[model samples]
Target: MSQFPHPSLPSSVKEPWLAVNLSLFFPGIGQLYAGKIIRGHSLIITQVGLYALSGWLILSQIGNIFIGELLLITAFALSIWGIFDAYDCAKTANSPSFEKLRTSQKDPWLAVFLSRLVPGAGHLYINRLWFSVLFFTFFVISLLVQLVPILLKSLIFYHVYIASTIRRERNQLPILGMALVSILFSLIISLQIFFIKTHIADTHIIVTNEMKPTLQRGDHVIVDKQIYRFKSPQRGDIVLFSPPEPLQDNHFREAFIQRIIGLPGERVEIQNGRVYINSQPLEENYPQKLSQYSFIPITVPANSYFVLGDNRNHSYDSEDWGFLPRPNILGKVTKRFFPPQRIGIVSS
Candidate 1:
């Protein structure tokens, strides 16, 4: 705690509910109002750090927002903690952080109102030069953190300089350090964004209802692009492909995804909707629909493959479009990421 003297107070002063509400929008404002500048600054630092770290970690998984849950949970926890702490301090009139406002000086109401409009304005009104400068620094740091997209930023980590230097007189080092850190974080975030966009991962989404009840439409999936480079897409593996052309209602002329129903040089047929390979029943861990449709056994071409969507009744597959050309094969779908409740690695 600072060795600052408390200004005397009158009898009728009420508790500082205003500070609690202010803390809701701006984390440090309540601490400033209660004369707990250091505590307010601490809260500001903590909130900014958590937010920046979250941005740096998992911010860029397109179409699915799995990373946002961590951010939302941390933010909610911080807000509640800050609000309750500020309110408690305010109600305890003698708390070191809460000081009685002097009526002879600028009204507390005016100070709070000014801070609400422009954060540092309240400090400026009180003629506190250093407080004004510091609050503005914190505000700018927070703004920078919030402005960028989901990418990892480390700018706030440099607050260690300011936190440690809070009590040093005539110090300009922390400010300079903060500016440098901001520039560095900005550059890093930009570079990361470029790398992610250019180095498109082996990630894709289940884009059709043909795999329904197993892989739903719009489910973000990770494909093992590297695996097929060494080995073939195996039986029952969910593979993403460059479909030859538009099939059924799917007009995609490029990448398509389906389960490899039969591998190279194998005989495949469907009897009463149960798939058979080489005249023997094929056991499948994945669900199969019962249908009376029968397919005569046919040998899969030497280099080509046979494929089908799990949704047999609705899907246009090898049974409809002949064997899936081997060139159309890309990689296998390995995970699902949409609909946060069921987010996990795709099995089977």
Candidate 2:
């Protein structure tokens, strides 16, 4: 059993190695590792209680501006407290009081707690480099994944703040409005970036030899969802859009990049090898050879588009799948970035 300095004995145990100042930093943290479990638990509980109280105050909406400020301060203080607790516990882990206790018997609960609480950080203090690296890697990626979006959104919010500040009063309401605007802007921007980064509909290309000569199999393409956002998709503009009805079983749903040969509410027909929209022939410029064979066409409905592959004969586009909704439009192929020889802006 570890010897403790009792009231009757001369104080013989080495002075507490951890500075009392460190304990002041984080309540229960230092005490827990100092073989003072009761005190440490009390501190942790107290901090948690304060945090709960702060959360309640914010949600109550009683003078929210002041409540928000108080909550922020409380959170900041708790973070500082936890940090100091970690420092204190780390420094005194091998103090004299712990010397008589078998190293194996020393409670590592607090260490484990810290590890769980902050991942690699707690392990670093324990000198577990390998475990720390694993923890750090996982947490860093997770943090960056979350933080990047937040930061991007925050950037947008700052723009809103600048714009709104030009007219609004510079009082607390303006500040609150700015904060809310920033948050909303950040969310929208972050969502856009995330979707662009994650969704394949944002990018795709002709993978099969079907669309070759016009759009080569090896061509890498970008889909622009914003193309038809302001203006309607016009004839001859290459559009990337999902098919109204997908062919092939297990082909859940997929987007097709094709040229818009006919617009919504327009009578479209293919005779021999020519495309006529509203009985007028499509104006020419692109690889003219694709128009060598005629296919059946029908009038496109409102909010729908007629799409055809650059390699007209082989592409299974609107001719095979049906009209693409304007909302289905993902983007226009503005450029072809792969296969150096083919690297150029994809022309209409």
Candidate 3:
């Protein structure tokens, strides 16, 4: 065996051999090789913690904050620190006595961020087959669960004349009266030929009578589907929607018109023609008379609706058909244009 003196290494040689100062450019590397275990751990922990916190904040949809800016700054700084620390660690000569510890090169944050954009890419790169498959599955499921339905509903509402201008009111209107007005305007525009041809749907109203006395048969009414689609539909707001059974049917699952008597999750009862919601008697302002023919009380299903006709005794509606599913509801009926004489704003 060749006799050779092992190159000398200082016992406490600049504890941070990797240059902790360079860590400001990249988060963990400087501490990793610097031999300062606690400090390095802290740097890595802070970087990871900050990144996680920023991601959660973004998912929350909380706007009007400087979080994004701060995150970007920290990320850039950490990346730079990592690059410099890596260069310094590689340059430090390994002593012969101890086996040379060749530092491993990695761009973990960069790889993770890029892969996350495509869902499962990073895991695939890391050879985590199961996690990659799970990520891809969840990604597809999320698109179907959230994005697809929203797009479908938007298209349905558009065909039924729920225009975008009024559909966007829920986000803008704070006062109830303003919100109601917005719904009214949305309805009026849906019936006009100009509006109909343009495919605008807006407004909310309830039909008390059959198409004959109330709205002429074949006359199209537009309802603001976006109002309650975003917020909760109120007790008096006349919502135009389709019943669940018809929706379940293979054909004719497009749209149906009706009035909102009870909101989702509320108990509704019709006794002797008069209406009672949650055991409280509902007021009838439009119909000339009240006839309590059906005696039934039901709790409105979640994300579903309870509807009725203005002409209680004559009209066939939820009392006869079934609770209307919110998904089937294209928009709220806001306007009636067939019979000129009966043309006026539909009231709550």
Best by TM-score: 1
Per residue, candidate 3 scores C-alpha lDDT tens digits across 59-105 of 22232114643675686687666655644553443343332322232
Question: What overall lDDT goes with each candidate model?
Answer: 0.63, 0.57, 0.50
- Give the per-residue lDDT of model 1 (tens digit) for 1-348: 332123343332333545564575557767666677799898898888776665434333232235545775787798788877876666665533324332323433344435544656656665665766776667766666754321112222223223331222234443354345445656677687566543433567676888877788878766655566667778888888776654634675757777887888999999977989999988878865654578899999987888887788888788888888777776667656567776755656
Stretches of candidate 1 off by over 4 Å are 1-202, 245-251
Top candidate, metric lDDT: 1
| TM-score, candidate number 3 | 0.38
Supply candidate 1's per-residue lDDT for 301.
90
Q: TM-score rank, highest first?
A: 1, 2, 3
Q: How do all models score by TM-score?
A: 0.47, 0.45, 0.38
Separately for all candidates shown, the number of backbone clashes (residues 3 or more apart, or on different chains) is: 3, 7, 22
> What clash count does candidate 3 reach?
22
TM-score, predicted candidate 1 vs. hidden true structure: 0.47
Write the residue-wise lDDT of candidate 2 on 9-48 in tens digits: 2322212222232343345655664566776787778777
Candidate 3 residue 274 C-alpha distance from true site, Å: 0.9
Better of 1 and 2 by lDDT: 1
Candidate 1 at 52: error in angstroms?
A: 16
